[model samples]
Target: MGRHETISRRQLVQVQDRFIAAWGQMGAAWGVSRTMAEVYALLYITAQPLNTDDVMDRLRISRGNASMSLRALAEWGLVSRAHKRGDRKEYFIAEQDVWALSRKVMRERLRREVLPLLATLHELRDATDNRTEQPAGAPLRLASDDEPAPADARKPVTAAEVRQLNDRIDSLLELVQTVDRLGERFVGSDGKGLRLAANMLSKII
Candidate 1:
């Protein structure tokens, strides 16, 4: 290669390395697997699909790690399989559209994290609803003189306290439901809703 072409290639390689590392860090923050994010970043920047060997070579990851990351990325809809004519090896490609990619990520987060949190909160709310019907022998019983309760005897939970806790849970549930609804609207269909919503918000802002 000519000097100019060689320099350009070297610069591109540097940028790719930087991006892969940065993306992996971001993925860790987002609770995604770092190797998976790096693998996706590599494929995202490359012009052609890469098989398992190519991915391992580029990222310096073991065969098992590369395979697992590729499988996970595929599960998240961030990567897809491709075949070259006359090639038996399975190659992978990343989702190139930024909007679609973001929507997919958000959808997974809503499904995996937000929904489960909401369910747990609902269970807590139910548990707190019937404070009065607490079993006969409550843990926080105040000791009488004859019974000689412990010096550190604590006051039992009251109906008012339960009501307050229930109300707080309700408030949190409302907020989380709003988020879930908004996430649903943003991620529905094939990426159009997200783009339109973002564009409209940008214009308003």
Candidate 2:
């Protein structure tokens, strides 16, 4: 059967129910509220393209809630506006391709959440290091001949700590760079290429 004929009324209802529940679970994991997840699920499961009114009617949700949810979905790239033939009003449809949707959502999260945190961490590290001209630890400081330091005295480690911190930052930056590269490849590659990369990424991730 063709795509249109494959999805039946009973199947749509069942899929909608399952999608709604799954959305609740996934949303919680992603820091979204339960109701928002339900809204997303409603959009994801519908076989027919729907308008805001359709969404509100199917989900039995308020117009304001439907509007808010659709806005959020648009921002995430999971749903987009559909202009129907001879229709003045706009309809909406979920991205039918799951892989593309996944990529968009992941990229958004990495950009909005991970990259900012990484920037903040770098800023803090810089601020902490800028206060001192030389290494803080006695180990980093040149020993004075007249003031003979005791053999038992351990060297101070302020400089060493900073170096270690910088090293960690470098490692994290490398990982981020790799992620960006992989994201680019995924976006540009064909199905066979994406499948191979996905298999590799699963092992690494």
Computed on alpha carbons, the lDDT of every model, listed in order, comes to: 0.88, 0.73
lDDT of 1 by residue, 118-166 (tens): 9988777766665677786755332335865677848888879878888
Using all chains and alpha carbons, the TM-scores for the candidates as numbered come to 0.81, 0.66
TM-score of 2: 0.66
| Candidate 2 off by > 4 Å | 1-12, 32-36, 85-87, 129-157, 168-177, 184-194, 200-205
lDDT of 2 by residue, 15-133 (tens): 77887888878888886666667776776676567888887887888999888988888888878888988987778888777777767766677778767766765565565455466
The alpha-carbon lDDT assigned to residue 148 of candidate 1 equals 56
The numbered model that scores best in lDDT is 1
Of candidate 2, the 10-residue stretch with the lowest lDDT total is 135-144
Best by TM-score: 1
